[model samples]
Target: MKQLNILLTAVALLLFTQEQAHSQIKLSDIFKKVTDRQSSSATSAGAPTTSEIGLGIKEALQLGVSAGADRLSVKDGFLGNLAVKILMPPEAQKVEKTLRGIGLNSLCDNVITSLNRAAEDAAKEAKPIFISAIKQMTLTDATNILLGKTDAATEYFKRVTSAQLTEKFSPIVTTSLNKVNATKYYSDLTTQYNRLPLVKPVNTNLTAYVTQKAIDGLFIEVAKEELKIRGNINARSSTLLQKVFGYADKKKS
Candidate 1:
């Protein structure tokens, strides 16, 4: 009985010593592995440098801008898409209603069509403007966008380029309105409305109106594209895009 007790104590001590040494070795290895990962994670884990993120965002913006331009620059781009279709300004609503009530529905329709046509024409020039804004993006901008809301990039564009867009788009909208005889139709509507009893004259700047609406519609499309790229795994084209947006995807999951 004594021998049995002695044997058990020795075995227990041996196991305790072995376990303590094994745990020390394992803890050291684990810490070393963690340190190595921290050191290499910049180039590892599909390391996406800031510059790579910048380029990826730029590429995505370029594609988004080009796609938006192609879709909007065509006939019925705005007129056909009720989601983005431009309606008469607030001041023109009375004019439109009065004209339509007088059996001048065709006249009103022509004015509406011409307005949308002018917007579509002005939209052709938006691609370059959007590209310019994308090119102006810096590493900081890219990083923030990658970590921001789906529409964050689009909002950045409004902050940086709205003034420039307004300046460039106003003239084109004016030219396009004239080219499509939108002015003639608008004038006819307003002249008739002014002749109506108890109606105030509308001196709305159609050029500025269309220009602002066109810019708004352009941003809507851009936001949609940005959302699609951010949310859709298959939409990520480049490796950098995969890395940057993949991080987003993981967080979302």
Candidate 2:
């Protein structure tokens, strides 16, 4: 299945490359014809030669990081946003359902809600870390990314910032969870659930679980914002941003 998926992706990529090359050829030919006609008529009467407007690796990625982090730091950012809401994973969901089925629904619900709240609160601190990464980008970074595949910019940001962001965000998530009483809530729930009839009780780690979930949610939101800024003309907030992101926009369309 994985190999088949890879094959399909390669085919799609080839088609996209053909289309892009076709467009570039068509546009270049048109421009050359126009330039020749203008030169024959009058050199000064022609439109000025247009420079390439594509963003290099450094600029596109820096813009992506900035735009993504900006969106996350705003009011209702990750907390109130449904698209980035942190929810229980499959394993944890099973545990919750099992506890609920055995008459421990209240505890399960408390733990679930509190875990999400902690993640939402923790999401606020993501901007600084992302900004720091963006600041470190250089012209070489831009060139390398321009030659890479789709989502290359995002992948680079993940490699550089994921660990640092996790470290910075973990403590905040932990504090938020504790502040919301998620630890005690899960503890009491587990106690009651464990006491249930004929069940093998298992201890769960709430802090570690919430920490992972929170970070996952943060990255998901950041990626969405990055994709938008890279693809959508209306999302560019500055002159440099528009120029930089225009490259990605053209690459997509």
Candidate 3:
């Protein structure tokens, strides 16, 4: 089964060698495998190849990361996109309600805005981490991911990279939160809420909140980009992408 997968991948990869700019492949198609066997490459399997089949996986990751990062890490990246918008953390919901009920609507709004801005600021630092994680992919990882369900890569990243990303992002989120006065806004809101009659004091970690939110939003975009490649032919963006993903599509049908 593993040899067969490699043979099929290698044969499809030939389309990329004909000056057709086959380097641009989709991550979903690259990971469109359904086995949990040992990882094998086209060359090792003697199927014929210019590069390791894992290269295709890596390339797809690059595209997904670049697109995901580009779509985010910008003005209103998290704030404007409802799909991935950063909002008041669950623990702070009552604080928001209390603040809003107390007629501090502007304060509530500012705090939410600042949280999102911090997310955007911290998002800029994600590409290098994402790329590093991509480099860690093994042939087994590639094959398993390709054969797994859609968003499997996203789940893999979330599983493996989430902790590292949070560690890396926390300080950046802290800095960004401070830069955006999210800390001050949150502090002011919390301080005021705590003083209210019988209102519980809140001491949430603002940086941790934004870090996780940023990571979540980042993956949402990555999944979207992956789905685009999987389902939309126009979204494939390159001959290699078309050929590799077209194979997946044909097999599925």
Candidate 4:
């Protein structure tokens, strides 16, 4: 009977030990899982997702395009700003100089004014094209822009939209030039210059020249807007902009 009691006690002790070991394993597993979940959450909290980055980039571009278009579409936006003012083409510089020397300054002034006016009119139509390009940006493109140089976004826009902008701006510029009498004035100026003794015939494509200049001016404005958003915290108007650009700032630092 004593031997039977000893055997039973040993069995009970063994079972208790096994139960404690099993409980310890389960507790360890639970703790590990909890720790892992907390770590994952913390990591996610610090970094912006790919989707967030893309959205932020698009928003910034939209703001840039809108601001640029609005500013340039206004009166004297190109003419008043010497930085982007449309000047006579290189080949026609002598014509302007000769005309001015002959006291035809008023005619030269009119041509300059009309050229700027046509650019302003075309600038108003650029917002839609820029917005469309912004919408079409892929995740990879957005990621690259976010991490690229200060004017990387502007470069991307130039690459993607230049051809389309030219195609669209050609007709608009042509019509605007005709509407503003730029074509007529330039034709008259060139005709007069050609009639001059020993002067080469100078027939510049006013439409092409003005269209390219207008596009260049628009890009300059866009670059400024992009720089503002990338560098200035206040320019980040939305929460997403703040979050994504904040991440970018940290990464750059």
Q: Which of the numbered candidates is closest to the native, going by highest lDDT?
A: 4
Give per-residue CA lDDT, model 4, range 37-116, as digits (tens).
99998678887999999999999999998998899999999999888999988998999999999999988888999999
- Give a tens-digit lDDT track for model 1, residues 1-253: 9999999999999999999999999999999999988989855775477778888889988998889877888999999988678888889988898888989998889888988998999889889888998888889998888888879899998899899889988988899999999999999889989998888899789999998988888888888889889888888888778887887666667
lDDT of 2 at 126: 71
Instruction: Report lDDT (CA) for all predictions.
Output: 0.87, 0.66, 0.81, 0.94
The residue pairs that clash in candidate 4, if any, are none
Which residues of candidate 1, in runs, are more than 4 Å off? 1-43, 251-253
Question: Which of 1 and 4 is the better model by TM-score?
Answer: 4
What lDDT is reached at residue 119 by model 4? 95
Question: What is the lDDT for 154 in model 3?
Answer: 89
For candidate 4, the lDDT comes to 0.94
Query: Per model, how many backbone clashes are there?
Result: 0, 2, 5, 0
Give the better candidate number (2 or 4) by TM-score.
Answer: 4
Return the lDDT, model 3, position 109: 95
Tens-digit per-residue lDDT, 35-152, candidate 2: 9988887644332112222233334455665565555555545556677655554545666778778787778777777777776666677767766776676556654554455566
User: lDDT of candidate 1 vs native?
Assistant: 0.87
